[model samples]
Target: MQNKNIIITGTSRGIGYEMALQFANAGYNVLAISRKTPQILIEHENITCLPIDISDENQLQQVNEFISKTLKKVDVLIHNAGSLLHKNFTEITTQEFQNIYKVNVFAVAELTKICIPFMEKGSHVVTISSMGGIQGSMKFAGLSAYSSSKGAVITLSELLAEEYKENGIAFNVLALGSVNTEMLQEAFPGYEAPLSAKEMADYIYNFALTGNKYYNGKVLQVSSTTP
Candidate 1:
């Protein structure tokens, strides 16, 4: 997939950063977006780093305009930016739920809407969901908001895949398990490492590059049964 133009959100660190590196290594032109620009991205010849909050509509519009001018086509779009709120149900305020929805669900949908004009048939859109979006784990108190937000992402991917089927666009969700990222560290503090970010990125990159049409609208889980 040399010379494929890709747009990825949440690239300041963690899974997003890994994805940017992996895609760039594969010779894809990558547009990496995050609230803050990372130094490593500055060194990548095929990567353009955009520092903008995904949740802001005006900024998203600006990003859309910039991408339209810079790239002829968007072959891939990966939505990876999200927030986690680890608080009990009762402790979560209305604002907290709204904030989670804003970042996790709304931003993804809105960005996809804006980017669709720049995409065409053979374009792939992947959302970074979680196993938490698939099945509820035991005693995972304080994760209701996070889980629910991810569930929305899964549904969004499915609906987008269905809606764009005639256009030859593919949409899928990567429902990941415990990846050894800062998000996981915060969720399971002091826990042993699970999977390396590069390994996870490799898996996701391969999936996005080679997945068949039938894989569209499916949530593919990536994780080992044992850490």
Candidate 2:
């Protein structure tokens, strides 16, 4: 991954921040986007932190232009930003549902669409999904909106993989179980500490770099069973 240009969303904290550090440490040029600039990325030679909200298509277009001018090709694009609404289906308003969909599903699709043109064969796209997307459970009482949005993200990755297969672009979704991130803590306060963000980042970075052949279009679940 050395010297490759990669764009990672949601890098202010948690999994996204960890992923940015991992990629930068591997000598990859990282364009880290978040609502606020992260301190760790301020002075890094290999990292460029941009304050961007993925839901804003205009801002993403600006980002697209900046990247296209700075780098010849975008080697990887990681859609790691998402939102969660921990409310039951009956309690959620239509606007709330739309808000979650806007961030988790719509933003992902839009960003991918804009970035795909600058990508070449052997490029990889990774989306951060959740295990809640695959199976429903009784542990969470108010996760309908969050879970549904994640399910859409998985489907989006699958469809993109098929559509771009002829172009040799690989797309994969990393469906993580509970991880010890701020979002997980907010969603499940009483749960024990799960996988560390760094651990998950390592797995994701490795998969993006080396697992392309066997894992494309597949939802690789990262849980207790995952190494």
Candidate 3:
């Protein structure tokens, strides 16, 4: 059987890196995109590491060109690249907020827009969100910017689901809880998470492979609730 093609962002480290490896191991052709393509991902014969900053217009165009000319079809898109700025509500500047949105929200929109032409009937798009984005959940200080961006992501996915239904495309957001990743460490120093990056990657990979069968336009919260 021919391998399916998947495009993943933030492949330099953490969940994105692990997902790329796991997807490749699962016999998928993975196009790993990052600002800096990690050497490890490049070494994987099934993975093609593309160095493109999603927030940069020129670089994003390069990705569009590559996908148009090279890939005939894309099966899945995992949007994992994001920016989290820990700051009090008052301290968060407009530019800072926009920067986070650039990677977390706008980048996803732009890439998915360009890739729509290449996606077939069964294509799935998943964006990695956070518990902070979940409405009615406990709000944390110094996370207003990040949380806001994630909220946008959830809503965007929902809207995309409606808009792309005619194309048989599925859009979902994984509102993940704290995972043991570099991003988590930077946000909350010394805090331990119930799940590791590899574990999260495994779940995400499986979901991307088969999630559309059950749900679309949903924000699936992934986390351990035990206190």
Candidate 4:
């Protein structure tokens, strides 16, 4: 754990921030990426804060370079960055919908492609999805764009798991329920969540390291509530 290289995006705040902090505290090398670098990570020597808009494919070259120079191999890659649009279905513009997918879906694929070469056998790729992505889950009205984008990534993870299974790499998606995240607040104001960001990040931290041995190409719905 002390020597492993973990790349986790969306570390500016919320669950991503906690995940980065926890991994750093555990003595692992954490490459934390987000549009804005979180100050909390600045204090941790093991954590490398990379502030970049991951939605842009062009900006991903920085990550590629970082991995090539800093860490040749990636032990874990967690796609935790996401975009949320809480407007009604009809009110959402085409660009807004595409922007959501750009962060939640396209960036996941683009970043994974760049990290695959640095992954070795026993490496794991964990994608952070939403409960809305699950089929038959309680659907929200203003989340058409966000929910569908989440679901798209779920399928993407499944396919990647199969494609990379022979290479000894594993891919899995966690469709999480409501969590006390700023994005959640934007999506549903005044709604209390059953879990906190730290709690869920802890679960994901453990899962990324050990879950591959038992699960791959699987979607784990990590939720305790309907909403």
Candidate 3 lDDT over 1-227, as tens digits, reads: 24799999999999999999998887788999998888878888889888888988678888777777777788999999989888888988999988998999899999998888898889999999998899987778999989989999999999999999999999999998889999889988999998999999999999999999888999998978521
lDDT (Cα) of model 4:
0.94
Q: Where in model 3 is the C-alpha error above 4 Å?
A: none
Model 2: residues >4 Å from true position, as ranges?
135-139, 225-227
How does residue 125 of candidate 4 score in lDDT?
Answer: 98
Query: What TM-score would candidate 4 get against the native?
Result: 0.98
User: What does candidate 3 score on TM?
Assistant: 0.97
Which candidate, 1 or 2, has the higher lDDT?
1
Write the number of the candidate with greater lDDT, choosing between 1 and 4: 4
> Which clashing pairs does model 3 show?
none
Q: Compared with the true structure, what per-residue lDDT tens digits does model 1 show for residues 57-157?
A: 88898777877788868888999898998998998999999999989999999999988888888889999998888855433678999988998999999
The per-prediction CA RMSD against the true structure, in angstroms, equals 1.8, 2.1, 1.2, 0.9
lDDT of 3: 0.90
Which 10 residues in a row give candidate 3 its minimum summed lDDT? 218-227
Candidate 4 ranges with C-alpha deviation above 4 Å = none
RMSD of 4: 0.9
Which numbered prediction scores highest in TM-score against the true structure?
4
Highest lDDT scorer: 4
**Sequence-dependent TM-score of model 1:** 0.94
